[model samples]
Target: MSKAIDHLMKVHRPKQKIQNNRLRSVIVSIYLTKFVPCGDPANANGGRWLLTFGSPDMKLDDLWQETLLGMIGDCFSHDSDPQPLSRFITGCVVSIRVRGHKMGLWLSEAQNPNIVREIGRRWKSMMNLPSTIRIQFETHNESGSAQQKPIYEE
Candidate 1:
């Protein structure tokens, strides 16, 4: 990807103009999911388990890769559940920001605290996060709204 970016930059750097806002960055998002709309019965409610980093951490890349693999690779399954816990996962996102970086695990249900919290706990363990870092689960209903708040944290 870096090589491709370098090639693109080499080709466009000479013609670079402020008017065109293209090919400015690397990867934007990695969304993993099966088809299911907002109205789908399979997803009655939805939320995201959010983990924020103060600055770009050395482990960010590995954590993101691990999280991506855990979700799509069925690493969340255990003895307690009949199905893989990842079944409830709708998608995952990692956002790069100036203030902090955020890793989100979007889920199919937010109304159920049991599984939601369980996922949060497992997520912390998966990332091997220190206790100092807290991961919060915020319902989609609350995201970017006045009511935006985390219902669960680990």
Candidate 2:
């Protein structure tokens, strides 16, 4: 199963590191935190966050990984003239729980209105999100509060 997933994501399979399920979760959490962006200007504005809410039986964790891999592949399909915006992708995450599932895409800059909007548009296209859904971008400062509001909505 792990090998199949690795192939689908176009990533080298990681060797099992822990026997205990709880300990494995802790180790994975630590590994994931290493990708958090630094406070440099390129990343200071935070990044675009796009989430996909899927039904409980959608197995969205797998779906998110597959979608990300597919997007990455599409970005580089031009060989020598790949899209510039692809470079802005910083990280992505998927969360699946008893209630539902969500996937997030994190980019490097959210300050440029044009770039942000383009990224959002391309993302919706590449991910093939349903036409009924509207994408939005929320800056870090604008998202931390209890009554957080998005900076822009499409």
Candidate 3:
């Protein structure tokens, strides 16, 4: 009976392609931070804030570029709807503030977000998490910014 069960299991095993897809679909939580200029010289030369999102199944680097391009598209002029920034947003300099993790690419004013809300909304959707994901866009400004300054620290 044990031999028969083993044979049945082997016969029912899935192929490699099926296994790969299943693996790829598995949800993976990744922490991502997007920095946008806030238009303040004291806070910095440009107006910007740091927005953080938790994503699943998306690569960190790819998501970073996507988030940047999405923000830039929302603010500046893009040739097309999808926009050309999709390619340019990648391979830019990013400075990550998280401890023990010296990661990120620094995107220029042409790359960072002029509109913070658009970026925040996009980030939340990209995460694709089943649960309600909280995305916060934080900048160092007293008032008149697109979004409010984050009171709670990550």
TM-scores for all candidates: the values are 0.74, 0.63, 0.32
Pairs that clash in candidate 1:
none
The lDDT ranking, best first, is 1, 2, 3
Q: Candidate 1, overall lDDT?
A: 0.69
Deviation of model 1 at 37, angstroms: 8.2
**Candidate 1: residue 103 Cα off by (Å):** 0.9
Q: Over the full model, what C-alpha lDDT does candidate 2 score relative to the true structure?
A: 0.54
All candidates: CA RMSD in angstroms? 7.4, 6.2, 15.7
Write the residue-wise lDDT of candidate 1 on 1-154 in tens digits. Answer: 4563344334322112211554333223444555453445555578889887775544666787677667656677787786678888877766654456677888888987888888889988998998989999887766768868788889
Candidate 2 TM-score versus the reference = 0.63
lDDT of each: 0.69, 0.54, 0.34
Which residue runs does candidate 3 get wrong by more than 4 Å? 1-49, 52-58, 72-94, 97-119, 127-132, 142-154
lDDT of 2 by residue, 1-154 (tens): 5554465555421112222233222111111224544454555676656564645444344445545564545451333533566666666655443344445566667777766777677666666667786666777555556877777666
Name the candidate that leads on TM-score: 1
Model 2 residue 151 distance off true place after TM-score fit, in angstroms: 1.9
lDDT, candidate 3, 1-154, per-residue tens: 5563454334311223235565332222112134333332322422222333333232444544444444444333245545533332222222332221112222222224533344334344653423443543333343245666643221
Q: Give the range where candidate 2 is weakest over 10 consecutive residues by summed lDDT.
A: 24-33
Candidate 2, residue 43: Cα displacement in angstroms equals 2.3
